[model samples]
Target: MSVRQTRKYTHKFHAPTTLKTDSIFYRIFQSLPSTFFELINQPASLAQAYQFSSVEVKQLAFRIDGVFLPNTSELPIYFAEVQFQPDKKFYSRLFAEIFNYLDKTELINNWGGVVIFPNRSVDTGATERYTELLNSPRVTRIYLDELTAIAASSIGIEAVKLIIEPESTATTKAIEIVNSARQQIIDAAQQREIIQLIETILIYKLPRLSREEMGKMFGLNELKQTRFYQEVFAEGKLEGKLEGKEEGKLETIPQLLALGLSIQQIAQALGLDEQVVRQAAQPKL
Candidate 1:
């Protein structure tokens, strides 16, 4: 299976800590209803997904991982940031950048903002700073790890991974979730993506499982032909186009990069060799 190219900006934002956050965020966004795009004035399908800005605010230069602008003339723009660590200054920096964007854009309109944290404990900002703002209803903070009421729906399974648990339990649950997802999803493309996601999770949780178990888990042959598998292949085509071989880079490279895939993963996603991806990573000059 080929790993596709993600957005160039994605390369700037990856790390072990962020990978889990990214996976969950991507899945959440993917699973949202079509009306979500309508709410944000975005396209209906997941085709043209995210618009990332390395310099969301000049001088301040915040990298926005995902953004969705309202289609209606009157609605406010939505700014989203994903944080996996516990930083005390999170809100301080967040509001600073937000006001900077508001001032720079001269947006004399209302704005909606969301900050997603892996778990409630990861949020270290002073509640006092956001007390009034939280009361005002324009901002929301979500902690993925704190949600452990009961699994009323399938989405609840993804939510459990955010919890701080023994590696063994997490691995067991992840395996259960993947098995369930594979059996439940009929769409080949979506099913493939789910399996890929499961594999990615297992790579991190490998310490919890025996080497033989891990190998057996990933040894399946059907993984190479799933929709998720093909998408990664498509990413390679994008990398080629971006290199000006056949398709335009603007259309291809940035698209894959935007998906936040790793260079190696992108290479695999596209069915290209690692050397090709490494070469593509270099500047035009």
Candidate 2:
């Protein structure tokens, strides 16, 4: 008898902290593109005139966490970087990605850069070499910890601040944000999205807590009892049953991939195995 051989496969289950933070920022930008302009102290109206996206430099093998492209040729494009950890060579890498993007695109427009940090403590990246660029108006650095004073009035800004909130008080802050969302946001879907975002931020902040525990801490139980929640939950259940089909789930992989969801997030949201999602996400010849 001939000996049989089998292939072995290894799977990467979790996303790194940096990737998670990037995803959160991506979601915030997607749901509320205005928030980016708000953080940079620009007119929030500008967000309506621009579309946000994540860009990849295929040849150079670099990916920008986020980019805002203007609808007209007059406005400058913005490159956004969310740096939660310290990296000495961050500017070197950032400028490389920015210039490469400029070379690759045919669009002719001025450009700017925005770097977001939790606080000045983690903004340890060396800027000596790029001091001129850093000092120019083209670059904006936002520290989340310094924005707490404005969080009370702005739901989007409050959500951003929650990312750096301390463990002991994160839950309380989350509840306050949720309540504020209910009162301020008249749209039911928007309200749910804000609440869901708050839940997600807490999940990243308190990794040790189970989803059930986090849900309770955020008053999800009470929120779920609301009419809007019931409607959304019921619609979700119906959609889940329909998408439960293998073909339906496969069709969704590309859409989620386009939205910049990580394999882990796509798997969790679609009720599919990570390896399966990975395989589906791979490009075909």
Listed per candidate, the RMSD to the true structure in angstroms reads: 14.0, 15.3
lDDT of 2 by residue, 130-203 (tens): 99999999999888879866643477887887887777988889888888988888887787788778877775
Sequence-dependent TM-score of model 2: 0.68
Alpha carbon deviation, residue 125, candidate 2 (Å) = 1.8
Q: Give the least accurate 10-residue stretch of model 2, judged by summed lDDT.
A: 1-10
Against the reference, the lDDT scores of all candidates come to: 0.52, 0.72
Task: Evaluate residue 143 in candidate 1 and report its C-alpha lDDT on the 0 to 100 scale.
Answer: 59
The worst-scoring run of ten residues by lDDT in candidate 1 lies at: 1-10
Specify the highest-TM-score model's number.
Answer: 2
Q: If scored against the real structure, what TM-score would every candidate get?
A: 0.55, 0.68
What lDDT is reached at residue 277 by model 1? Answer: 67
The residue pairs that clash in candidate 2, if any, are none
